[model samples]
Every structure is written in structure tokens, then in C-alpha cells.
Target: MAFPGERSQPRGTILIANPSADLYGSDRMALEAARGLVSLGWRVVVTCSVDGPLVPQLRAAGAEVVILDVPVVRKSMLSARGMLSLGRDVLTQLPRMRRLIKDEQPDVVLANTVTLPFWTLAARSCREAVVVYVHEAEAALSGLARTLLTAPLRLANGVIFNSETSRRVSGWPGLERRDRARVVPNGVGGPPETLAARERLDDMFHIVYVGRLSPRKGVDLVVRAAALLRDAGIEPHVELVGSVFPGYEWYEAELRELVDELGLAGHVRFAGFREVVWEEFAAADVAVVPSRLDESFGNVVIEALLSERPVVVADHTGLAEAASGFAAAVLVPPDDAEALALGLSRVHEEWTDYRRAARSDAPRARRLYGPESFHARLSQALAEQAFPVPSPSMKDASWSPREVLD
Candidate 1:
């Protein structure tokens, strides 16, 4: 792959495989890493089982993209029919993937998420360096899922975790003992040059939530929380700025019904999938992340902080870890609409203070999770895996303020 800028001699070929092509957190990071590697003079080829919005971006970044008809294990595929379909997919994809691995002859095989552990097996047979970037925390996995995901890491050359919470919850003590695991927190694009003043929205306190509208994401709780605020005689404008997942359109309908049932129709707006979501974050008084699942890292939280907007996240899972240091952030109990409401109420009452604190602490998040830091760490991790070198700086800190800030 080559970009428009001056290119260098190829370092080595790399094959990056992801489960889905949607532009979600994991997929987004995968593209970022692929683009970074390309810029570093690596010939990159990206493969995924499905296709979506990220295909054009991958090509624009000068990475060759190939859509493969492989079977990926999903959480929704736990039923009888789904299991049968999965079995068929695995049987067909096994030999096909093995052949592709042999043909590519890549120096490194990068697996983006845990759902596609088959890449590890294929890379092992080809004697190529294998790196798995785990984006989900252990608390979110079932017993069988956890076994399937970690059993292959024992053979992996390197393991990259998105957050410290993901690293600890992964229960992979052997990776640490072998000096194979590294925590590379997710990074985001820099915020706009200028942001709208938060004080300008004094008349209507706008609350924004960004991500998929699924049960696990807890969008319903946001609706309930908005209703609770309405009952408390405060009518805050809540703007939801994301669409539902592939099979979860009903969840969006359900949330709308919930809003109507609670008489919050006028107070809530579902703004589906905006290209410039950061603008929404910059305009809001506060951002909310009420995930019921154990998130590995909340990228939206960082985006909000970079936009200088205070955040309120659920206490459970990696959400609490994502909002640890910011004085502007408030932690509320997971799956509790009342708790979320109270947290929002607090932000509403002390809006300016939280906004000021958010601005003061925003640079810390950017300095740590910026693109330079992410690409630098990623290059080092891959280089060490390809050729084991000894260096004192490889030692990870016992605690990093950035690790807790997602």
C-alpha cells in the first residue's frame, strides 16, 4: 500500500484480519494501526468477513482490502441455528484461510478482535509473528468464549490490550510472565481548533450520547434517566448521536417508545450516525456512557474529554477506568436509571464547574492517547515481537494516569 506522500522501501508484508467491517471502536483502531504501518513503509493487506463504511477509508490510507466470506463468531450466534451456521462456516473457512496465509507470506499477522482467533491458528502454522489486539474486557466474556479467546494467546507472539482494565480482566498471567503483553491505549484524532463555548448553551442543557443503540450500550437507561430529570422538573435536551447495530433496529424503536411512554418525546432526539460527532460533543454540556457490558475501553469518553465536555459513565466494567482521573467525570451504578439521573442532575446543577474542570484536564487525555503515542507504541510492540530485543524502557509502568483515562 502507498499513500500520496513520499514512500520508503517496504519493511515487510503484514496481513490484518478483523471480524467485522463496521466503523466501531475496534474496527476504527484497526484501520488507524494499518494506516500507521503503511506510513512506516509496510506493505499492508486487510481482510474482513463483511464489508461496511471502513472499506473506502482503508483504500484511501493505501492499504489493500480484500473481503473474505469467512465465518466469524458473534455473541448472537449462541443458539442452535447460529451454532450450526458457525460450524459450517468454520469448516469452509479453515482451508481457505490456511491457503491465504501461505500465499501472503506475511511477516506479521494482526488479529483485531477476539472473535476471529482462527487467524492465530493460521499464522502459527505459517510460522509468522502473531499479534492479537484484544478490545473486550474479560468480565464481558462467557466461560466458553473466554477459553476460546485466551487458549490461542499462549501461542501468540504479542498481545496488545486497549486498556489496563482489559489487561487485568483478561486473566492472562502467562502473557505477562513471558513478556508478551503490552497495553496500548486507544487514540483519537485531535479535536477541532476551536470549540463552542459551553456557557453559550445555558438555556437548554444538551446531553449527548454516542455509540450503537443496543441493549448492552444502555441507551434505554439514558431515556429513563431523561424522564427522571423531567420528573424532577428539569427539561434537559438529550441528543442520541448514533445508530443501532446490524440486527438491533428494534432496540432503537423500543427506545423511542420508551421516550414517548415516559412523556419525554419533546426532550429527546435520536440523531442517527453523524459524520462529525465531535461537533455534537463540543456543543453539549455533558456526555453520557451508560454501558451495561464490561467495555474494554470507552473511546467515546476520550472523545468527549478531548472536546472539553464533562462525562458521566457507569461505574461497572471499563467505563469507570475510562473516567478515573477527570474531576469533571461522575461515576454512576450500572443499569440504574435513577443513579444516572442523579449524576446528570449533579452535572446540570454545577455545569460551569464541571466544564471548567473538563477543559483543564482535557490536555492530559490528548497527550497520552494521541496518534503519535499510539503509533509509536504499536511500532515498538511489533518490532519487538518480530525480533526480540532487550531494553529497560520496555518495562511497563505499574500505574499510568493515561491507562485509567481509556
Candidate 2:
């Protein structure tokens, strides 16, 4: 709600910082966030795990890039290897981030994603300007992630969330000194050409799900739904995208087996990760987000809307909130294979008009999710000016109180 015409005064030189690289969806979002901040005339500096698909892209976005050789690893649930692996790797990387922190001395250090709350700790000397952008779970927040991310998040000034759901899940709504939290949903802005060319894919129907094959992400649920579709005699050609995050190969094995067991071998294909998915969108008709738990927001759903592809999304978390009244997207409960199949079938049955309406309304949604709003909001975070308390000027101008607090 604080985006678009929420209309607050703005500033510049805000630091848009986060954990390194774009190998993951949230990481890719980090780069896009940096580009957006720069577009709004702010001095943006990105510090991520030094190696990944996004380092060069961040450099090209006119932001100062510092590589923190943080061994950023993803942990799997119901296991010990993932926990120990993440703890050891992140603990080792902690000191490396210290050197970068002292050197940058940025106005505000925006820690993109929950995984790198350590950046918040590093920015303590900078203070107030350390905005921790919480999109995904870190090692220290809840469940197992909380145990790992414990140390770094201690020094964060404000927490900027990608969705209200993520903020609530993280339990950092608004505390004290470092309790400032703002929910500025991630924006959608790729090449306009990607969107314009989507009309040519008018004939084919796509049931696209883009994300790593992880237990938490619930990629296997989609595979199961594919099987359910097969049982019903609907041959839904599923384009499974993204690879497994490191140390989570078992999740991949499970998904692969489910796909095989359901007799959907030819119907379902693992497409891995694609640099740009405009062509993939062209080949498909609808976007499917079937995450089982804790998705802050579904960027693919927004991107699908941009490409004018109708979305059938999991109805929990921010995805449900985002899909509210959107003409092109349909919402179904998470983990409900029956509902997933029903939604998918309904979308392909009547796709054209929804696609056109989606394209028409996408710009409005894009504006809500784009850089200008993000910059102004993030600038405020760096400035530590979120929810400004009224001063003498306000007392002099107005004399009425809306309500009494306690």
C-alpha cells in the first residue's frame, strides 16, 4: 500500500545491498532491485556472495559491487547435513563481510534476503541506515534458518520486507531500535520487448513453475499434480524450470521419482534455469506457482502477468494477497493436488481474453512493483525515516488526534 501513490517525500544515496549473486530467485531479485534503485537516482551498492550468475549484471547496473566470498549455501529441512553445512559456511564467511563493511561505509546497507542478515551486523557502525530486506528465510529466523542466521541480524536498523507474510513469518514486525519494518513488494521490470512479443504465443498453453526443486518450495507437489492430471486423462505438458540448490539433491531425486512414477515422463520436463524466459513464456500459456510453504511473494507470477500469461497460483502467503482481484491469475490452496489440476485446466480452457486483460493491466501492476516506488521506499529505509514521528511543525499545523494509543 505504500507504493505508487502512497506519496511520501523522497531522498537519494540510499545503499541497496544484499547477499551476493543471482543463482537463486531471490538473488536475481536483488540485482533487479539494485537496477531499480539506480533508476530512481540513488547511489546503489550491491554486496553479494562474490561469485554467481549476477555479479557482472550488478556491475552493469551502475552500482558499486563488492564481492563477499561468503559461502552462501541453502539448507534442507528434516536433516542434519544441511544445518551443519550452512552453519559452518556462514560462520566462516562472517569475517570476510567485516572487511567489506568497513570499506564501504555506505549511508544505508540494504541486506537483500534473509540469508545475509550479517550485513546488518556489519552495518552497525553505519547504524539506522542498515535496512535488512527480508524475502526468504535465513538460518536464524524460524525453524532451522533461525538457528543459522542468529548473529548477523542483531545489528539491522530497519527490515524492509518483500511481503507482509514474510515479515510476520520472520517475526520482525516492529521492535525497538532496529525494529523499523516496511513492506515494499518486489517490482517487475524486464525488457518491454519481452512483454510485447508474448502475443505471438497465442496458440500454445503454458503451465510454468519456475523455482529451485526444494522441499520448502514444494516442486514435488507440481509433479504430483502432473500425475493427477494424467490419471484424469489430461495430458498437461509441464515445463519444470530451475535446478536444485546445493546440498538439496534429495529433493531433486524425490521430484524426479514422482515425475517418473506418475507416468508423466514425456509430459513433464525439467527445464533447469534459463537466463531469460521470454521465449519459454512464448512456448507456454499459463504460469503456475505451487509453493507449499513460506513464499514471500511470487515474482514469476508478476512476470507472468507482465508477459500477459494467466497465473494459477498457490493461495497462501503473499501470492494469494497479490492475486487478489487480478484479472489473469487464479488462486488455489497450497498442497492441494486436486485444486492445482482444476486451476490449471480452467486456465487453459479460456486463456486469450484474460491474457489481453492481463497485458493491459500489467503496466499498472508494474508501476506498483517497479523501481520508482522501490527507490523512494528504500531510500527512506536507508535514511531510517520510515513512519516518521510528528515534530513541532505538525503540532503547530494540526490539533486533532485520530485515535488514542493505550
lDDT of each: 0.80, 0.65
Local error of candidate 2 at residue 314 (angstroms): 1.0
Taking every candidate in turn, the Cα RMSD to the unseen true structure, in Å, is 7.1, 6.8
lDDT of 1 by residue, 190-306 (tens): 566648445744476789999988998999999999888878877789999989876888899899899889888889999998756877887688899999888998888888888
Per-prediction TM-score = 0.89, 0.78
Q: Tens-digit lDDT track for model 2 on 198-306?
A: 4433333446777777876767777777777667666678898888866878878888788777877888888988877767775677778887775777787777777
TM-score of decoy 2: 0.78
Error of 1 at 390 (Å): 10
